[model samples]
Target chain A: MQLEEQTITIDGQKIPFQSGQTIMDAALAAKIYIPHLCYHPEFKPHGSCRLCTVMVNGRYESACTMPSVAGQEILNNTKELNENRRALTQMLFVEGNHICPGCPKTGNCQLQAVAYYVGMLSSHYQHFYPYRDLDPSHPDYVVDFNRCILCELCVRASRDVDKKNIFAISGRGIKAHLIINSPSGKLEDTDFAVGDKAAFVCPVGAILRKRTRYTTPIGERLYDKQSIRIVGDSQQLHAGATKYGRK
Target chain B: MIESLEGKRGVPRNRPPFPVTQGYLNKPTVVNNVETFALAARIAVYGGDGFAALGTKQSKGTKLLSISGDCLRPGIYEFPFGVSVREVLEACNAQDTQAVQISGAAGTCLSAKEFDRKIAFEDVATGGSVMIFNRQRDLLEVVRNFAHFFVHESCGFCTPCRVGTSLLKNLVEKVYTNHGTADDLKDMSYISQVLKTASHCGLGQTASNHIADTLKKFPEIYHKRLLVEANFEPAFDLDSALEDARQITGRKDEMAYL
Candidate 1:
C-alpha cells in the first residue's frame, strides 16, 4: 500500500506502515510484540486496557488505537514504560479473581502470558478478592464471571460477527463487570450457541466449553509452547477443540 | 453535559472532531461557560477596550471569586486577574491563613511562601474558586478529604483513573493512620505520574494534581505521619475485617471479636 514508503521508529527500529494503520497494527504485522490485551486485529481497537501504552514524541498514548504518523519517534518497551505496564497488569490481576495456578486457561491465557511478559511477579497492590458467580446453566458451556477482565472482546465479537449481541459490559470503574443478555441473566435463556464468534473471543478462562477443561493439558497449551509474543494470536487464527480460544 | 441533556449518564465521549466540529446530536455546536455569556453581554454594551482596561498586560478584566473557609468575609468578591494572593487574602480578612487552595479541590495549593504569586494567566491561573486554610488546619487532612471525594466520584471508565484514584486514597490513609513507610511515598509519585499521562479524559488526568502539588509544597505534613522505625506495616486491620462476619452471625460475645 506504499506509493512512497512511510516509516516510524519504534524503540530505534524503523518500522514501515501503510495509511490508516495504528502503531499496534504495524508492529504486529512486523512481528514486533508491544504487549497488548484488549486489541484484536479482527475487531475495531478499543483502548480500554492501557497495557500497550507507549511514548509518542514524549507523551504516552495507547499504541493500539493511535494512528501511526511517519517520522514519529516512538518508545515501545523502555524500562519506565514496561514498569508502568507491569503495574497496570498488576491492577488487572488484583481487580478480579485471577488465580493462575488453578485456572484451566493458565498456560494459554493472554492475561497470564502478558503478566509473564511484563514480569509481574505478584499482584503487588491489595487484592479485592471480588466474589463473582458461575453460570453452568447452558447445556454445552459455562460462564465464570470472576476471570473476565472486561476486555469487551466477547461483546464486540458477538455483536459484530456472530450477530447475537449476547454479552455486554455493565457498571462503572472498579465495579465494572460482564453481563449475559437474558431475562434471568442466565446463559441458557439467551440465543448463545457453542459455535458463535463470541464463544472463541475470550482471552481468559471466563468462557469455557463443558467437559474440555483439561483437554489439551497444561504444558502443551498454545502459550506454553512459546512466549506470548511468538504464539500471540494462535487462538485467533483457527478454531477447533485445541484452539486457545482468542480472536 | 450533552449526554446528560440527552437523558443519559454524563460519560465523556472520545473526540477527534471536537464538539465545535461535531457535537450535540451530531450537529456542530458551541458550549460556553455561564460567565462567558454574562461577559459577552457586557462587552456588547460597554465595548471591548473598556472591559479589558482593569488587569495586567496579558490577563485582562476582573474575576468573581467564590471564597470560603477561615475568612471573616466568606462570600463572593470581585478582583482583577493580576491581584497577588496576599492582597486577596487581606481583602477577604483571611486570618492566620496557612494555605490557599486556588481553584477548587482539583486546583493548585499555594502555601504562605507563594502568597506573592499573582492570580493571572501568566502566573497562578484559576477558575475563581478560593479556599483559605488557617495555620491550625493540617493541609494533609485537606488532601485526604479531596482524595476520598475523588474515589467515589471516579466514573471507572479507564484503567489508570479507575484504580489509581483509590490507590492514592489508600496511600494517604496509610500515612495518616500511621502504617506508612518511605516506600509508600515513592509509590505515590509513580502512580500520580501514570495517572497524569495515561488517562482517557481530563477528570482522570487532573485527579491527582492537587495531591502531587501538596506533597511537593508541604513535605512535613506527610513525614510527620510516617512510622519512623519501621519499613513495613499492614494497612488494614484484622478487627475491622471480622466486623462483617460478626454482623452476619449475630454474635455479641467476647469470643466473636478479634
Candidate 2:
C-alpha cells in the first residue's frame, strides 16, 4: 500500500506519519500515548471513546478523529488533557454495573489501567449502580454487561469486519442494551462461534475467553503490564485473523 | 412542582391533631423537585421552544449528567435534549463499553446493548453520570450496595421502601454472597413487585426496580447463584447476613452485630 507522507509535532516532539492516519494512529506510531478507548489501530476508528483527546494549535480535538496534516502542531499528554481523561474515567466507573473487585481483567484492563495512569483516586459524585448481567452462554467467550463501558468497538468490528451482523445495540441512550438476534437474547444463541475475533473484541473483560479464565497464570496472561498491542494484535482484532504481535 | 390546584389538601401522612383540623401554617405549602421548579422557571422565562432550543428537538432545555467510572474518560455533561448517547459520550469523553446509569434512585440501569440510544426523559432518566466500570467490575455488587444505601436512608414513613428496601438489599446480598437460594431470588422478585405497587415514598418503591429490570434482562447470573446444581458454588463472596446486621445496628465492632 502506497502511503501518503506527512509530518506533525506532538508534545513538542516532531514526528512523521502517513497522511491518512488519524492523530491517535500517529501518536501511537510515534509511541506518544494519548489515552483513548474507542479508537483502535487494527479496526476502523469509531472515535466514540474520546480518551485520546489532544490540543491542536490550541483547539481541543480528538486524536482518534483528527486526521494528520503536514505541519500540524499537536499537544498531547498535557496536564489539562490528563485531567479531562481522569474525569471521563471516573464517570465510566460509577455509571453502570462495574465494580472492580477480584475481576480477572483487573490490573490489566484498559479502563482500569487508564484510570491509574490519569490518577483518578476518588469520585465525589453519586454512584448510579445500574443493574447488569453476564453472558457466559458462548462456550468460548463471556459477556459481562456490568463491566461494559459502551464503547461500540465490538459492535463495529462484528458488523464491519466480521460481516456477521450478529451483534447490534438495542434501546436508546441510557436504556440501551446489547441484544442478540436470538429468542432468549442470550450470547449462546448468537452466530458467534469459538475463536471469532468479534467475540473477543471487547477492550475490557466484558468479553472473555471463557475456558481460559484463571487457566493461564496471572503473570502470563495478556494483561500483565504488557501493552494491548504486545499482548494481542490486530490479527485477532477484526474477524478471521489470528495474528497477535508486540508493538 | 406542578401548580397544586387550589384547595389541594392532605400531607402524605395523617395530619397531627395538635390544632385539630387546622393544618400547620394553614396555607398548605407545596414542595417540588429542584429540577422541576427550574423547568417551571425556564418555561416562564424563555417560553417552551426557546428553552427547548438548548437541547435536542425531542428533549428541550439543559440536562445535568454526573459522570463517574473506570472509563478512559468521565465527567458531568449538560447537553440539550434529543442528544444522542454518542454525542453525550463525546461531550464527556466517555468510554465505549461502559453502560449508562439512568435517572436518580427511581431510574433503571442501562447496558452497552443500548449505546445507540439517545438521552431523553422518555427514553431514560439518569439524572447524572456516576462512575464507569470495566469488565473487572460486577453489577450485582453495585446494585446490592445501592439497595443497602436506600434501605438505610429511607425514612420509616412507609413499610414498602423502608422495610422492603432493607429486605431487598439482604436478599440481593444473599445472592451475591452465594448463600441465597433460587427460591430466595423468586421471593426477592415477588417482594420487589409488591414494594413497587405498595410503597408510599419514591425511595421504597423503585429502589429494587433497577435490579428487577436487570433480572428480567439477564436471569442467568441470578440463577447461577442459586446453586441448584450439584456442587455448584456462587462466584461472589461478601457476607450478606453479617453486613445487614452491621447496618441495622451501626456497630461493626461488636460480634453480636453479625
Candidate 3:
C-alpha cells in the first residue's frame, strides 16, 4: 500500500512530512528553523518553553508538540512571532542565572545561541537571583543549579536512556529543581556513572565535567563554529550520525 | 486546577490530550464555570425553549453580574444577556462613570463611549463581572493592583507565564512609582503582547488584558504618569542594588547606602 506524501505549509513554504512526524521534526528535517528548546528528536516533546509556538489556523500551537497535518497552514518566523520569541528567550534569561560570558559552556550553549538567533539584544526583564547552592559533592561532575532552565532533559535522559533513575525534578512551579534520586540527595551518593547520557544532556552549563574547562576555548566551541540551526544539536553530531539533522 | 484538586501542584497541565480526554483521575471530565453550572441547573429545570426565549437573538437567558466599585447598588444583579453597560450602570445607580472593567482584572475595559455595548458573547464576552470605575478613579492604579494579582497567582510552570507576569508586575510597579518613561510604556505593551501571545494558560494569556485595554481606551492616564523629558529610566537603581550590603553592614551612612 502506498501513502501520499503529507505536507504542512510553514511561512507559506509547503514542506513534506511523514504522517507521524511532529511539525518540529518535519521543519527541522527540511532545514526550516522554528526556534525551540526542551525539544530533542530522541526525547518526547515537552512544550514548556513556548518558543517554537506558531500561528496555526489563527491560534497558537507549539510546533514541537503539534502533529503535522496535511495541508495545514502554519505561520512561523514572522516579525510578530520573532519578537515574541525574543521575549520568550528573555524570559528564559531572567528565569535563571544564565551568565553566558561567565560560564564554561558560553559559546557551546544552546540557550545562548538561541538567544542570539532570536535577536535577543537585552535581558529585558528583571533578573531572578534565586539563591541556588552549587553541588560539588560528585568528584567528577559539578552540578550548578544556577544555570538550569528546568527543561528536564537530564531528568528524561537519566530515567529513559540510562535506566538509572538518577535524576528527578522535585517541587512545583518556580521552586522546582533537578533532584538526585539518592537517599543522601546527592549525585555522588547515587549509582550514577560519568559516561551516563544524563551527564551530557544539558543544553546549558547546569551540569559540567570536572577539569575540562577552557579546553577548547570560547571561540573554538561547537556553537561558535556554526549556528544551532545549521548544526542541529551537539548530542546527535557527537553520535557520528545526522539522524535528526541535515543528511 | 485539576492537578491541585488531585493533591498535586497547582501548575497547569499541557494540552493535546485535553482535560476532556484525560483529566483528574484520567477520566473524561467537563470543567465549567460557576455561572455555567448555574445555567446548567436552570436549563435542567426550565426547558431550552424557555431559556432561549429571553435575551437577544444571539445570546440566550440571563447573566449574573457582580456589580462593584463606584456604584450605589453594589451587589449581584441578574440581567438579560443583551443588557448594555449603560443600563447596568443605571441599574446600579453608577454616576460620573469614566470606564467599566467588564468581567475581571483579566477582562475588557469599556470607555464611556462604549457604554452602549451589551453583555453578550458576540459583543463584550465576559464571565459575568462588571466593575465600575468613576471619573475620580485612576486606572493606572487598577492596572498596578491587577498586575500584582497575576504575579502572585502565576504557577511558574512555563517560562512565559512565570517570568512574564513578574516582569509585567515590575513594570507596572515602576510606572506606579513614577520611575517610568516613554520607553517603559512601550516595553509594557511589548511584554503584554508576549504575555497575550505565548503564555501557556489563560491566566498568563489574559494577565495583561486590562492593561492593554486601558492602554488603548485610556492612554492619557498612562502618558500623564511618564517622565517629562526622560525617555529611559534604569530599573536597576545603583543605590537600591547596595541595599543587601547596607543591610549586611547595618550602616545608615550616605557612603554606605550607595
Identify the leading candidate in terms of TM-score: 3
Q: Candidate 2's residue-wise lDDT over B135-176, tens digit each?
A: 566767667777777766654433344345656676787678
- B116-206, model 1: which lDDT tens digit per residue? 9999989988888999999999888998999888887777767788888888998998899878887788778788888887777778888
Q: Tens-digit lDDT track for model 1 on A136-230?
A: 99998899999988888899999999898899877876777889999999999999997887888788889988898798888988788788877
Runs of candidate 1 with Cα error greater than 4 angstroms are A1-3, A234-247, B3-9, B40-47, B51-60, B239-258
Report the TM-score of the second chain of model 2 against its true counterpart.
0.71
lDDT-based ranking, best first? 3, 1, 2
Clashes of 2: 66
What's the TM-score of candidate 3 when only chain A is evaluated? 0.93
**On a 0 to 100 scale, what is the lDDT of residue B45 in model 1?**
93
State which candidate, 1 or 3, has the greater DockQ. 3
lDDT score for residue B80 of model 1: 82
RMSD of 1: 3.5
Model 1: pairs clashing at backbone N, Cα or C within 3 Å: A173-B156
